[model samples]
Target: MAGCTGATSERTAAAVHGLPEDALLDMGDFAGAVLKYLRRHPVDRLTIAGGFAKLSKLAAGHLDLHSGRSQVDPRHLAALAREAGAGEDLAGAVAAAGTGLEALRLCAAGGVALGDRVAEAARATALGVLRGAPVTVDVLCVDRAGVVVGRAAPAGPPERGTAGGAARQD
Candidate 1:
């Protein structure tokens, strides 16, 4: 089983190692804004997705001093990913608990955006977590005038914007 062990090590190395800082997932069809965002800022979603997986075990091993719990939970990782703006990969990685890193990587190939919908979807998929669900988290994209842009809130009813045709924040 030495070969098996070697293979496992190799896979782990890949996950922890080199991946484009600008690389984004290619999940079928991507939206225009996401594409635009990536084109404008070609970075690997802030590297939190990668850091979370790599540092989890190390963090867990020193639980007492760190006042830590049993291990790093998906939500914890999700928070890190969000702060890092790593997007869905953060959700998947934390949710998988080290198992679905590969799938997360694949999904992240399309790229990660700190958008309202993506964060909401990731939270729901990862752990049935939702925005403002005990964990106070809101994804707000605002312009120079401090005006909110992008998503307003899916479930909430639509409201009129200050200017006609302008996007509203719910």
Candidate 2:
């Protein structure tokens, strides 16, 4: 997992519990390293989760999951609000939020299912990254309080469609 700091210790604990190889990806060449690792040792499944703010970028197919290297585009958040049927005022609020969590709060206040959209986006990004591999992906979105806000799983075979992907964050 990238950006494995603070609230993301669950991933580290889970990784430690498992009896297998673990590596800290180099931020400079994250995608290359991930692809190489996958090629060297194929896996049956992959699960990724992270903070809500950080996960937004990872959900966008960004291999470099470092917060410093990536960001949640407010435009995307606004689009999500609009897709969820949020009024223009709510969308504007989401777009103007100073932080992802703030945007999420705005969505909650406006009764928009932003978490689901974020989860789906994450799944799509993960699928895009592992486009050709026959791997099952699970994406989970969690909040700062360590609560699951959203989740997604591959529907079926690894077809080249936008249905399945993996990774999540809080």
Candidate 3:
């Protein structure tokens, strides 16, 4: 014979289901209400500035671009750079990537050591532009907070600082 279910258990399950259903229910305009609440509550906001170059540290070890004859992996490059203290320029470059996640990926791929390597790579490309190598590369510079301070393509002229410093003649 089949066992009969108890009404108490059925009621309990129904009650449990009703409580969590709120998550599934759509709360139209709830975000506006929350924003209003926060506005009234007065929470402090912090501004963080960083570039794609630094954030790329997260994935720097995975990149294998421009490797030939036992090329250093991105992670190895990053680790080495970390040991050698090569974060700043790379971070600046990553910050210059125009987006947060892209910067992070570059950081991860270039690794710490790879930061200098990438910067070197960028410098080499810049130098090639100087030498009329005919290869096109874009150079971007950012401050420590990841804010883009400069961008230059191999074919374009250098940018001027906010105070109108003399433009780089090269």
- The residue-by-residue lDDT of candidate 2 on 81-169, one tens digit each, is 78878899999999899999999889988788787777677666655555557655555567776676655654323563436544332
Top lDDT: which candidate number?
A: 2
* Model with the higher lDDT, candidate 1 or 3: 3
**Residues 1-170 of candidate 3: C-alpha lDDT, one tens digit per residue:** 00001223223223433323222212121212222333344222211111323312212321212223122234433343444455767745643555444543565566443333343333332232233222222323344433343333223113211111111111
**lDDT for 17 (candidate 3):** 33
Comparison by TM-score, 1 against 3, better one: 1
Residue 2 displacement in candidate 2 (angstroms) = 12
Q: Output the worst ten-in-a-row residue range by lDDT, candidate 1.
A: 161-170
As a TM-score, model 3 comes out at 0.21
Across 1-170, the per-residue lDDT of candidate 1 in tens digits comes to: 00001223223223443543233232111122232343354332211111222223222221111213234345554554455456565565645654324323433453543233233332222112111122211122222233222221322111211111111111
Question: lDDT of each prediction vs. the true structure?
Answer: 0.28, 0.61, 0.31
Error in Å for residue 16 of model 2? 16
**What's the lDDT of the predicted structure labeled candidate 1?**
0.28
